[model samples]
Target: MTKWLLPESLADILPAEARRIEELRRKLLDLYRVYGFELVMPPLVEYLESLLTGHGHDLSLRTNKLVDQLSGRTLGVRADMTPQVARIDAHLLNREGVTRLCYCGSVLHAKPMGLLSDRELLQIGAEIFGHAGVEADIQVIELALESVRLAGVEHARLDLNHPGVSRAIIEADPALARNAEDVADLLSTKDVTGLRAFASETPLQAGSLDALIALTQLYGGGEVLQRAREVLPQLPQVGQALADLEQLAGFLSDYEVSFDFADVRSGYGYHSGIVFAIYADGWHDTLVRGGRYDGVGTAFGRARPATGFSLDLRALAGGLAPAEPAKAVRAPWGCDPALSAALRALRAQGIIVVQVLPGQQQSLDEFVFDRELVCEQGQWKVRAIQ
Candidate 1:
């Protein structure tokens, strides 16, 4: 085995792709700044408890754990930055009003999420804390949609789900509530057969079983909301969840929006209300995922209303067209004052200048030397390459 060979599902980003990812990161961070989201960078690793608090088994399974040599305690590499940002809002900042924060960093997953996914991801996102209303949800969703739009993603589809719909039905039945996790797994997969089997094995009320079966078919365009009202039980919580989805859909009338009640569970169990995932044609899976995860900061001793969205920059860049190589001016290696001044001036003007070193072949993947800087009649000037 070669020492340079990376593990399965782990790969390095070459020059062109890396440049595109960096550019996307800069654009997104700047966009978030315009929306009053202050940037924060949490450490890549932290105590396992701090990293995993409030998030459920899914995040735990994704996080890579190690023992801290200095503190002799277990530590975890973060798989998600949301909880960390929440901690910052609750403990560090302790602000009274709504706090908007944004972050961009790499997160390590214990395993690849899909066949085409990389174990290492460049995660970028924005979060709003201390606001509970649907207004915050609308803001984050718009920001999320705008993110892909800015990246040149056309015809993106937004699939919305509220765990409360399923949660209400399950809570109404003791048997389903007791086995919520197993039930959620089945529903998320849309395994009607598996659901029937599980229901038969467990003691459940007829109404709850019927409702669970009804959820599997409640996925589609805006009409799904109407069908849900007719098919699902008329519980107050279910009514409220449907109303919330209707409100969100109405506000997002400008874009493609749909609903899927069977996607009842979030990747992390912390999401307390409306959950959403964005899908586009080229992408095999969701490009972005987020929603309201209110009270996520309670583990840090202060609970606050929060909503946000995050996407893997690497995954996003992979679907886009390759970036064009940057134009540059080639300069010969020299100690002459005139050559040095020309190089400095071009670079200061944001122009790429590739200085050829002695006995070295000038090769670059991210830049194309379209012009040359030369001394003509004792004056340094740039000329187009012929």
Candidate 2:
């Protein structure tokens, strides 16, 4: 293989795509800032234990591990940044009330999430810590929806789910609880056939089995919540989960919202409350995923209610149209101080300016020179290319 070749599922981002991703990152961080969210940038790697704290097996599986040279301890390239942010809120910031934080950084996945996904992702997100109410979930959901809207995504759909419902049913039966991981995997895939096969193979209580099967069919419009309350076992947690979903849906009248009871795969399993994903037509999978992951901070010695959402900026940009080449003022190679000053002035004004180097042709994929700086009457001036 060529030395410049990247590994499978990893590739260098070229100029046009990189520019689009950068623009999206700036727009999103600015939006988060306008909502009182303070930007925080965590490191790309951390001690394995600290990085994996409060996350589930899925996150661990995605994390790329290595040995630290100095400390001689195991370190991990982060597959997600939510847990790191939680630790910051718990131990570093140590705030007492509601705290809003946003972050944008590169996260490396051990494996591609999908056939077309990359191992490297520019993850950008915002989180609210120290608020347990569904109101916090509502705010986070709204921010997530607005994120895609700002990206010019049309007809985005919000799908909501609560792990509490599935957890309650799974725990109500000893047999199912013993194999929680398998059961969760089955549910997340919404494999009713596999669930029934597992139910038959394992000695699940009739009520739990019925509820589990009911969940597979409990995905649809707003009415799914009501149908869930009627069809599923009347457990306290299930009732509370349904009520939370109802309340969340009620507040989101402007956007299209739906429910998916069997989608218990709340990203990294730290999600302890209402979970959500934003889906649009252009993207093959979810554009954004997040929810309330209360108590995740406890691993860092301070438990706080938290709700947030994150999306891969690269993936989001990949779905959109290619970025247009930036209009630039092309200047010829020269030692004149006036030409240098003119280039600086235009660049300082945020205009794209490309200075041609001596003895070389200028080739750019991201810039199109529509104007040029030339000496006119002993002064450098910009004139439109004819």
Model 2: lowest-lDDT 10 consecutive positions: 262-271
TM-score of 1: 0.97
Residue-wise lDDT of candidate 1 within 1-386, one digit each (tens)?
69999999999999999988999999999999999999999999999999988887888999999999999999999999898999999999999989999999999999998789899999999999999999999999999999999998999999999988998998899999888888888998889999899988998997888898899999999999999999999899999999999998898899889999998556525689899999998888889999999998999999999999999999999999879999999999999998899899999999999889999886788999999999999999999999
> What's the TM-score of each model vs. the native?
0.97, 0.97
Off by over 4 Å in 2: 267-269
How well is each residue in 110-205 modelled by candidate 2, as lDDT tens digits? 999879889999999999998888788888999998999999899999999999999888888999888888889888888889988998899878
Give lDDT for model 2: 0.89
Candidate 1 off by > 4 Å = none
